[model samples]
Target: MRILVCGAGGQVGHEVVNRAPGFGLVALGRNRQQLDVSSPEQIAREIQEQRPGLIINAAAYTHVDNAETHAEQAYAVNRDGAANLAAAACQAGIPLLHLSTDYVFAGDARAAYRESDHTAPTGVYGASKLAGEQAIAARQPAHLILRTSWVYGVHGHNFVKTMLRLGRQRDALGVVSDQIGCPTQAGSIAGVLLELASRYARQGTLEWGLYHYSGQPSCSWYDFAGEIFRQAHELGLIERLPQLSPILTAQYPTPARRPAWSVLDCSRFEAAFGLAPRDWHADLGEVLVELSRLERRPLEAGVRRA
Candidate 1:
């Protein structure tokens, strides 16, 4: 099957493109520069030209704090771009698999969030993503919206990379402890999406709709940072482990309020897809090894060591 993967420059999109071939898929990847989702004309032209059997939209305006001030830009990409894709997919008689986030919730729930839970996004980024989800549901019948959290990978700017960079530079660091969420690996998400794609290829349908899929055993940022440092040290990706201090969210406030409880109940997804969530520790180890390999590569001009 031919799959069109948008936002190919992002972490999840990069993983999807690289791993698609192993699933017997022909993936056509388009970065923002190549196919900006915010531009309807560009999306229409690309969909027409590519004629892909499936479309996976990993494009998103993910800057939580920046979205507070840049609401228009955020909506342009997250909301309108998603609507455009859904409409085009509907017109083309194809299915769309779009990535979403746990931010759709208000973070006040004590229990893990289910797909049917009430949504009250507290910030612009979350609101925009929720709007995107709504748009897809309205426009496309054959759509799958996967809401994930704390996504990190080897190819993008994420919490894992930030922790690794800080661990190398500082002897000690503080991370927010009050906030809790699953640290999902980008490669694992890509693998799940490809598996679904393969199933759709064979069956020509899916029990599609909104679903929650995240890492198992939720932890705070502090805990995630500690794990990253431990794994990186074990892999020789980090020379030494940095001292980590757990602080409340108030100690580190941002323009956008992060979800205090981002844990998602992925039972519905597992039941529907028949795939279980992989242990995030194993995924973290794999990411650290990949980062190690990248660091060991001969550095070329304009390429800073990761």
Candidate 2:
């Protein structure tokens, strides 16, 4: 079966495009330049031309802080774009798989949030994403909205890459210790999505709805940074582990308000799909190894000396 992957340039999208073949899928990936989800006509044209069995909308306005000032653009992409895709999918008689975030919740809950939990987003980014989810649900019944958190990978700009760069430049670093969520790997997310696509291809149906899929063993940003440095240093990706300082959210203020607790309950998804979330620590190690390999390529090509 052929699957259309929007946002092919993104971390998760890149992984999906590369790994789809292994799942017996022909992936037609389109970046923002090739396919702008905000435009209904463009989406319709592409869908008509591609004639894909499944459509995965991975494109999103992901800049949290930037979304505070640029709510219009955020809504344009997150909300309107999603609605456009859902309408097009409904028209094409194809299922739509969309990627959402954990920010839909206000983060005041004492325990992990379930899918049925009330959504009260605290920022523009989250609000826009929640609107997108609602739009998808209203427009198409054959849709899957997977909400994940704290995604990182080797292919794109993310917390892991930021930490690696900062670890090399600074002797000491401060990370917010209050905010907590699962550190999901982009590859893990891509794998799960492809698995769903494969299952859909075989069964021609799915229990489509909102589901929470994230990494195992949640931790704070400080803890995540510590693990990054530890693994990177062990793999020779970094020369020294920087001193990481745990700080409050107030210490690192930004335009957008972050969730104090972003943990999600993914039991519904597991029970429905029979696929458990992968261990984040194991995923982290795999990412670090890939980063290490990328770092070595320049030296191997004689672009940088030992």
Candidate 3:
């Protein structure tokens, strides 16, 4: 099947693009002057050029804090851009796999947020993403809107890479601990999208609904940071173990507010597709092992698996 992958350089986009050999893939990004999603005409043009059987949209204004200050840009890219893509996909008679966020929730729920959970965005980024979600839902009859949380991968800036970098520079670090969420790897999400898309191709049904996609187990930001650093420390890349002091959300002030509980329940996705969600720690270890190879170093003393 032919597929069009937008935001081809972001974490999720990069993973999708890298795994595109299974499908005929047309990848585009902002850096490529040929592709500008902000313009509806351009989006329509690209869709026509690719004429893909599926469109996977991974593009969005993702800087949570920055979105607070640049609400217009965020709205234009996340809301209007999504609308443009959905309209173009509808015109082309194709299903779209749109990646959304869990920030749409208000974060007060004691249980994991399900696909049917009520959305109450607490900040500009969340609000903008929610708008994009609604736009896709309004127009596409056979779209897969995957709402994921705490996504990280080998590509792009994410908590994992950031922690690794800081772990090397500073002797100790203060990571926020109160915020609990899942640490989903982008590669895993890409694989799931492929599986779902192939299944749809065979059955020819979009199913037309939202689903939560995340790692099986959940954790706090501090827990994620500690895991990342623990793997890094094991790699012998850093001289000393950085202090991972857990702090509250307020201690780490930001322009945008994040949901205290961003964990997404993946039971619906699993039941629909009959695929199992992966353990985040397992993927985390794999990523760190790859990092060690990239760094050309041996595993350090007392190094635990990622």
Number of the predicted model whose lDDT against the real structure is largest: 2
RMSD of 1: 1.9
lDDT against the true structure, per candidate, is 0.94, 0.95, 0.83
Reference-based TM-score, model 2: 0.98
For residues 217-273, write the lDDT of model 1, one tens digit per residue: 899999999999999998887899999999999998899999999999999999998
lDDT of 2 by residue, 129-234 (tens): 9999999999999999999999999899999999998998999999999999999999999999999999999999999999999998889999999999999999
TM-score per prediction, in order, is: 0.97, 0.98, 0.92
Error of 2 at 205 (Å): 0.4
lDDT of model 1, residue 211 = 92
- In candidate 1, position 121 carries an lDDT of 99
Pairs of residues at least 3 apart in sequence or in different chains that clash in candidate 2 = none
Q: Report the poorest 10 consecutive residues by lDDT, candidate 2.
A: 297-306
Q: What's the lDDT for residue 84 in model 1?
A: 94
Quick one: ranking by lDDT, best first? 2, 1, 3
Full candidate order by TM-score, most accurate first? 2, 1, 3
Winning model by TM-score = 2
Worst-scoring 10-residue span by lDDT in model 3: 23-32
Comparing 1 and 2 by lDDT, which wins?
Answer: 2
Clashes of each: 0, 0, 1
